[model samples]
Target: MTTQTPAVRLRGITKSFGSNLVVEPLDLEIGRNEFFSILGPSGCGKTTLMRMITGFETPTGGSVELDGKTVDRVSTRERDLNMLFQSYALFPHLSVYENVAFELRVRKTAKAELDTRVREALALVRMEEFAARKPAELSGGQRQRVALARAVVGRPAVVLLDEPLGALDQKLRKEMQFELKRLQREVGITFIYVTHDQEEALTMSDRIAVMSRGRVLQVASPIEIYDAPTSRFVAGFIGSCNLIDAVVESGRVVVPGLGAVPATLPDGTADGARVVVAVRPERMTLSDQPIEGGFAGVIAERVFLGDEWTYHVKAGETELTVRVPSGETSTALAGLPEGGRVWAAWPAAAGRVLPADETASPLIGSPA
Candidate 1:
């Protein structure tokens, strides 16, 4: 039996600028047709990693492979990959059709094939009607589509997008997120997306690699990444999580102000081990009435989000944030104003325990 090669592979890849270590040694494999995201804050080396894969920068160690072929010394043009940027680098004077056709022209493709490919690429991005329009005449979203058409017109083996949607407004960015995913599926090619937006990564990625200080911390599906973050940084960075410092005793986590809460100890964790209990804000429930084994607090503040309201409850020294859905629904905590007293409750399975020391914590992965 033969094994299929991954679409892209990085083995022991490391990069440094002079004496400054930009990326730590890392190994990663992206499967065929996968929408993989490298997420992190600025200066976390995600863009540098993308550049390494594009042959724009050479790695200090190890190799980059496309379909199992090492391409450490390959020129950018020779490698089977295409890159799309945030600025949508389209020629100001060229029509969208010519922009998409420029790549094929350079390759000396047959005229018939070039015309067909350009039109097909334009059609794929739903921009065929604007083929004759110059880049200067198009809207930002339209320009983005034109650039996307140009990127995939040559049908490269992999596409590397470096914060491609960063320039768009929030509404347009959200729209393009779905569009980007749809286009990737239709093209059936590997997509390595680099972004610093957490919501953007969560919305579109098949798997996310969360990076911090040049190291990949964790790589997993979006659901798993959100629900099962392995480190304190991952827990705090991925979403709005309540990371309560606590100590484990008798199979429960004892928070400084919130008292004890049920938690499933990770393997090898002792009774007196210091840990942090991570719970998503939305997982916590607030009741106007006191309940058994629940923490009591007064609302510190209330922020009204369109679809939901976030209630910040102050219980002793610990403050817990709860997300309550909007509308006059029975479950909604509508009349609970700031300074209102309430009790917070969550099932035992809601909290995930992690080691207290961040350095003792493990790696995590991602773009935003």
Candidate 2:
């Protein structure tokens, strides 16, 4: 049997507009039928990367491969892929059925096959009933579904979505997140989704490539990316983290006021080297009693987030945040008001020690 090739591959791909280098040289592979996401804030070059893939923006270096063949010289229309933009880009003069059929029509597919594929695509998106309606006559969500149907109607090798749900309301966007994943699975096509929304990437992607300042920082499964972020930028950008200044002492990092907390150290880190102890707010526990290897502090503030309570505890110059789910246990442990003394504790494995110099240096922009 022959080996199966990856759906998409980028080898040392780099791009720039004049003197501005938007996309750094990078390599990545997206598997067939995989829901892959390129996640980053604005100006991180995720859009430029997608454009390079779709042939809209040529790379200054390296090559793009689709289904085991180089496509550097291929035109966007001849790349055997489709793109879905945030605007939906459906034709106002045509009905949903016609928009879905447009690709097959352009290819001059047989009438029977085009009709069959168009209906199947519409049905896959649950838009078969609205096939006769124009873009202006449909809701934002419906139009998005129509756009998705158009993108997948021709059974392309891959479909690139550049924030397709950016136009919808928060509620609708959340709803479409699942819809896009479902449709992707049903169609059995590679989906290259680019978005700055961390939750969206974590919610829908099988694997995620997190980018910053035109560079790919880390790529892994959503859980792995969140739990084992390689750098400070990744740890802080993926979620809310308590990044505390500390100094390494063998197996533990000692915070000035909090004492020594056991943490995992990076390779080659010296005992006296400065480092940052990164911990998630939700991973920490608060108690009125002093905890071993923990910090004793007073609750400075508490934020109520419906289902969870976030407590800001002040211990000397170092402040730590702890998130506790709203429940009887939370009230008992984290219900303390301001000035109430408590101990903030976490398991040894929860603390990740990163180099001080790279702790939070790379700046991240606003979410796309």
Candidate 3:
């Protein structure tokens, strides 16, 4: 039996600028036709990693493989990959059609085939109507579409996008997120996207690699990354989470001041060892009346988001944030004002015990 080769593979890849190590030795594989995203804060080495894959940045150690072949010596132009930059690096003088056809023109493709490919790419991005327009004349979103068209015009085996929608407004960015996903599905090409936006990564990627500093922290699907983060940093970085310092005793994590919160201990977690328990805000439920097995608290503040209500509850010394979906059931809490006493409770499985010394800090911050 033979194993199929991955679309792209990184083995012991590392990069350094003098003594400053940027990307640590790392290994990863991106399957064919996968929408893979490398997510991290600024200076987390996500972009550096993508550049290495594109052959724009040479690695200080190890090798990069494309379809099972080592490409350490391959020049950037020879790599069958296209990159869409965050700046949307479109040509100012060229028309949209020309910009999309740039790669084909470089290859000296016959005019009939070049026209067919360019038109198809533009149509896929819904920018065929703007073919005659120049980049300066288009809006940010439209220009982004043109960039997308250009990137996929040649139908490369892999496409690299580095924060391509960072310049758009929130609404437009959300719209383009869906558009990008749809385009990827239609083309069925392996996409390696690099972005610091957690939400964007979660929304678009089939799987995400969360990185910090120069190392990959975790790689999983959106739900797995959010629901079962391997570290405190990942739990807090991927979404809003409540991390309460605790100690494991008799298979349960005992939180200070709040008493023992039922939790499942991670394997190899010795009894009486210090740990951090992570719980998503949405996993907690709030009740005005005291309930069995629930911790008592006073509502410190409440914010009415359109789809949900976020409440900060003072549970003993810990301030726990609870998210309640807005609707009839949740509206019952509307009468409760600040200082109103309530009970906060969650299922035992909701809390995940994390290693205390897994990283230097629990907070995820962009590297300097």
Candidate 4:
């Protein structure tokens, strides 16, 4: 459990094209052997930031660092990094073995050494048997595995993956998530992955840098990013949440639809100040009897989802959804139906009060 120094760093990173400032100046760090992800919606600048890191695109301002040394002057090939693209970028005529060995050959490694490294790389990805097959001969998932094997064969200081699993089927993509994580751990290299897929980032990252409008909103572990988001954007983007308008008073916040939630009011959280209150669906409880520190709502709809049931309820002008245990709760929810009387109760501690101005913000970017 020892901490390691960062393998990569960026400071005041900025990118702009014509009149458009695509990415604002930002700072970031990637720890050695850490599986980090830069995630956001398309056009949010996650890719732009990554391009700067991989040296495919130069930053308009600021510097890029590797192992504490400034690398802005170095070319991509000289930077000790390899990138796997979303397109796979394999040579059409080259067999998988040749494709994986291209870089080794380019460096003029001895034939004997190249054979050993190429075979080891294929074995690392469990694709040694498919070396004779061309890219077109393999399935999309298999081609992706080949690309991964090729990227790691060089033993670069870091690996950058740009939506590497985008073309695979849902089940295969899910399977590859675990596979990629295992590979990253086995190699012990700094892995900087970029994706717009929240689930993918959450599933594979040691820490995620959630970007929006060309800037990072938060950098934290997946669980911390999901459970204790610093902004309304992070709260709504990482998971399902109910954002209610509220007013602060006496160290508590009174939500419009829900009641007062127990919370601390820092010096800036004034009495009567407007704010937004966030509550997760799983944190709430539905009960027949009224409970302390809870709100009441009518059940609007119920949908069974295999192991669990989702109950959608409307309170005032807002709709609230909650997931409960399947069997018995499914029957109870079915009986409740749309517009049926019911109470939605959640612990006061389950809700977080935030500044009202940020409630409408998207999960990826800045404050609303």
Superposed on all Cα atoms, the candidates' RMSDs to the truth, in angstroms, are 2.8, 3.8, 3.6, 3.3
| Model 3 agreement with the true structure over 1-368: per-residue lDDT tens digits | 97879999999999999999999899999999999999999998998999899998999998999989999999988998899988999999999999999999999999999999999999999998999999999999999999999999998999999999989999999999999999999999999999999999999999999999898988889988888788878888988999989987786779989888967665655788788888999988888877788999999999989888899999989989999888833444778999988899988889877767654432222111
Question: Which lDDT value does model 3 have at 292?
Answer: 83
Candidate 1 runs further than 4 Å off: 327-333, 359-368
| Residue range 1-368, candidate 4, lDDT tens digits | 95665899999989999889999898888999999999888899988898899888999999999988898989988998999987999999999999999999999999999999999989988999999999999999899999999999989989999999998999999999999999999989899999989999999999999887777888999988887666677677887887776787676777665656644344455677777767888888876557565567787787878987788888776678887776547355556657787777767657666666542333222222
Candidate 4, lDDT over the whole model = 0.83
Q: Please give the lDDT score at residue 345 for candidate 4.
A: 73
Tens-digit lDDT string for candidate 1 (172-242)? 99999999999999999899999999999999999999998998988999998899888877888898999
Q: Which 10-residue window in model 3 sums to the lowest lDDT? A: 359-368
Off by over 4 Å in 4: 1-4, 262-268, 327-331, 359-368
Backbone clashes counted, model 2: 0
Error of 2 at 159 (Å): 0.4
How far residue 360's Cα lies from its native spot in candidate 4, in Å, is 11
Per-candidate local distance difference test: 0.88, 0.87, 0.89, 0.83
lDDT, candidate 1, equals: 0.88
What does the lDDT read for residue 212 in candidate 4? 76
Better of 1 and 2 by lDDT: 1
- lDDT of candidate 1 at residue 152, scale 0 to 100: 92
What order do you get sorting by TM-score, best first?
Answer: 3, 1, 2, 4
Tell me how far the alpha carbon of residue 68 in candidate 4 is from the true structure, in angstroms, after superposition: 1.9
